[model samples]
Target: MRRRDLLLLIGATAGATAMYQAMTRLGFAAESPYRGPITLEGDPKGASVIILGAGLAGMTAAYELARAGYKVQILEYNTRPGGRNWTIRGGDTYTELGGAAQQCLFDDGLYLNPGPWRIPYHHHAILDYCRRFGVALEPFIQLNHNAYLHATEAFGGRPQRIREIKADFEGAIAELLAKATRKGALDEAVSKEDQEILLEALRAQGGLDKDFRYKAGDDAADFRGYARDPGGGLAAAPSNGEPIGLHDLLTSRLWRGLQNFALYDFQTTMFQPVGGMGRIGEAFARQIPKVIRYGAKVTAIQQDDHGVAVVFEDLHGGGSVEEATADWCVCALPLSILSQIDVNVSAPMKAAIDAVPYASVVKTGLQFRRRFWEEDEQIFGGISYTNLPIRQISYPSTGFNAAGKGVLLGGYTWGGPNSYELTAMSPADRIKVALDCGAQIHPQYASEFETGISVAWHRVPFTLGCAGEWTDETRRQHYGNLCQIDGRIVLAGEHASYIPAWQEGAILSALDAITRLHKRILASR
Candidate 1:
């Protein structure tokens, strides 16, 4: 079966968490390979290079190349930096491809990151940049035991606490294993001594009683939580919560949500900028403000052995035609847009550009009158998974336990029929759908919702989609050509790296591309 079909099967049968695992295993995600700051040993001798797009990749190239004594200028389509590393704040406005515009009404200090938000500890390149630029970082909570996992048909559509499901599932599995071991079921696979040790370990792991049973008692309550409080005064005695039977737990399929917390990409120590994800882009733009020519949309790219010239329309200057010439070029534009622009390159490079498609995703941000998830539900941060078309709801990582209005990532859906369906609707309808679906998980959504804004990445005017959606077959066929320097121009972005859909990939791809370009330039001299 095709990769998408296989993933759909996994998602349908197993769940989103399982589908993500399969993606990672199939090379859809990978760790960054940044060791340290790159040093360009050779001099560029004032060689001029024009970079396309002022996103992370473009700015990273400009920063490094300018530091290496190269004259770098960047042309960006948007009037601001950070292509998809964006944040929507109060008073900010956005216009999609179909001319639907939205003016954000979030309160001060509240914003929504429609694109990349969290940075894993292992993404050293972005973290190094954040450190170098002095962008304040705070922990991004990916898993909160108090958060929820809901299946429409499970438990009469009632949501269950993550901690409850996790503890009960583990306890149930452990009890069964212990029973089998005690009945000599593992005698063929293990020695009697090892079997005894395993039984002891299982009891501790499952919070089972001395009788080797998982029951409603103090032992099980230790891991699964107590039904009543253990207070300092009278009536302080705690009561154990009943463990869900193994059959019910299995049938509920809530265990599918447990794997997400264990995924390497989303493990603890994840971080976001103190204010918003846009801070990283703002920091980069601050370093080289003069080099960026915002609102310049590339129309055509042509090159020869001597140098390269680019044709563009200055959207800020009455859409006048303009040209930029340089000795070299690092085109960091997204493939979704880049493929459509007239660019002179090898047939193979052009084919590579057209081969990769971008992923469709929709994210909706809702502002509420109060932080109900924190005030009422006590869910400070983290995500709640569901089988609904919205896929998941991620609570804000910042502004924990604050009093006034708050914004929640009310709905997030990856590439699927749901994403396309959401993308087809107007922004208003998307927000309404988000509110309706989210109300099922948190009934307070209907009452507390103030305003909301939704972004269907495919409808975005600039990127036209989310990140590059590469398959194993496409990567095998076109990834090499896409990265190769076609004459004086080379490509760099998340699309050119193994770790697609991440800032680290863009930075690393730029670093690698420019490093090779510098070497080639030095060799020519």
Candidate 2:
């Protein structure tokens, strides 16, 4: 949807609440860092820019600059468009760091987005790009009340429904607070008038009874769900499940994962491209195909006052070093790899390049013969968190209520010893570990599992690591140096933005970089 249409639709709404909801559903709820389509007001006078890495950041820069009448060329390390915005489907092959290649064995129409899987509602820059590129999107279910939260050491390795845990925890907290208020334990903290209002609010919020007790009854069932759902005729009456005691709930420590669903970033109205995350990159590729040269890996970068020159190897043909030069350069390459390259930049910029470390993450996708999680467990679309090395299992958000095969994100281990350990293992062993860990929560994994693929970000050749891990001190010291226009070269990518490891960050950083570059070009002319 265009900005004007979106504004008109929201303006036509009855109230702010309705407008907010409508804007969310239409993917225009948040204020974008991008002010609609960028228009480079001044001419570049045939200025040329060579962008490294054909990821979202580079493509975005190339797209905007080319439209603004600049000679734009994108040198990509991989043969495909999207860098981490990638997808693995049947018949596709991936080679990791150890020279081990794995061919995806997923069934047709099934795929795994090892990198960026969901677009948060607030990431308006990416959302706008998706809308403009005609990339179809579907709701990315962030929180499914039916999903499970399990810890092998807790609850005897059994998984609890998210709804039950959430309702019971809140209900228990409300009851305790209410009891304390009534007993005048909080007399000093809360006034009598406020105490009475608090008690009333707690009763309603916690599904408490007349005596303000959370127990097995219709009121509690309305929040925690029923032991047996209400039905027609003779069995119409609902049975309430007993609220878990505070002690048991606290000891389980499953409450730690519950807050994830409540975080503002993962709230409702998230989305993903209909087929895969790669659709975004492919769409961008369609707009500027000729300008992007795939399989061109940069080895050295040098910039003089006149222009910037990049030396790279043609990976597809024999590894012959080739040089590409332009009036300016936007190096979107990951800092992890860029730090190692021979780039002629100021000392601080080079130090800034090495200051930020890349994150390590491993993701495993398992294909099952049937939708057992949906049919047997009633888990439609959401993530099930666990303390195991596998971390989380996310059910596919697409293909809901459909009969046939299904794909599950069996494991996603981010950082720590687990990521390093998984990356060190062979692809088959990594898949095996994911299966073993997942089976602890979903026993059907042993039987229902058919084939799987795992991608360890550290092992990903295109990017040595997942994303730049910046600290407060690092950002304070080096962020400006890293982003500043160094001679005729500048940097742009997720690493350059405050919100790292997100597509929105990459696009925003690109937009910022290009805007500055365009200004410099106009001044030069």
Candidate 3:
């Protein structure tokens, strides 16, 4: 959505320095001093920190650490900065192709407040970022009906409970999944037995496990055998697969660890920025020294007793690998994407990176010629649906003037689809699917789309998906890998920060790691 639309929404609706920040700047978001290489303030010779990736997580960490006198070098895979937290511009106006949406969310009180944009609570790095930069968060705008799922076709009475929503899923085997969870997680402790049963069910459904960890890719197929087969519903398939994989069936609670903020859990939600989500990333980007590099990809990472060396590949056109070394390095890149990179880290670090997988998200952004669908009532955040692939159709340009007359609509699909598939699809096909869904709600919008494009994060090479997924094995293994490698390779980013997968989580992770590294550096002095 564009800017002018927001002004028409409600005229409508609407923090301090945070403890983690070094110094507070009024109105400006605080940038944490702990983002990059470890540095002690009193030293004449500064420390060198090689940061991988220039996304929000990497940028914030570099910003914080550099301010405290750490000389930093950032290597990014994308042609531009901002990894999953992406911003796209057609001409002058822009919209995010990927990332957590939020801005200016910390205050001088060191107290955190809700901002115009809503980020997942699990993301500790974001709060840490706000504290460092001193951006204050306002209250999250109350959404309508907490629309878990809304459609014009009318599904029926409201769910008696959240489980009912689960009951109504399109996957006929959903009930079997719920039943399997009970029989698998608790009823039967035999892990291997549970795996087989789940696989049978998933195979019966159109499901495929991208990671071959548990021989999961074997027998991956379409959902035909058990499409609500009552007999199959009652009987459990033989439980067997990789013991370390997700149960064929599971509960939504698994995601709480990732989002914690209940953002994805609720179906219908439209968040407008108090300022704008872009401002948040921009704020973090600003605090770092102007030396930050863009379009640099790290091809090889090697470390020795002296320091760590990194190689970069230019993303724009001509290619030359550049190398730089640092006393310490904070790797803020997403593990799901970074796993493929040739980094000479230990087996455990590599395994850890491979362990926490991300969810593939296909977001379709549509811009209209005019207020095509905003008739009857001036609608901003439109209906969320069960009938469509896209969860919600929102008009983000609800307020503001200078931003202009624009509308943004999207179709979000998670891991249910295949990897590397969407990237191969044409932009027209992606937009057609999104608009088709939107038309289901307001039948009037079937053909009025102006220009549309889709974001297939799974194919982004540098970011396999939009955010973290709630796989059984993934949840089990995320936390143990948070520490640095032999006290040198510090980890930062939404993935490394223990915040699941939100921008705030990225900031907090950077702060925590930086603070810890900061202490380590000071102690050495």
- Which candidate number maximizes lDDT? 1
**Which stretches of candidate 2 lie above 4 Å from their native place?**
1-32
lDDT of 3: 0.53
Candidate 1, run of 10 with poorest lDDT: 26-35
Clashing pairs in 2: none
Per-residue lDDT of 166-192 in model 1, one digit per residue for the tens? Answer: 989999889999999999999997899
**Could you list the CA RMSD of all candidates, in the order they appear?**
5.8, 6.4, 18.3
Give the TM-score of each candidate. 0.94, 0.93, 0.61
lDDT of each: 0.93, 0.92, 0.53
Off by over 4 Å in 1: 1-31
What global local distance difference test value does model 2 have? 0.92
lDDT of 2 at 504: 94
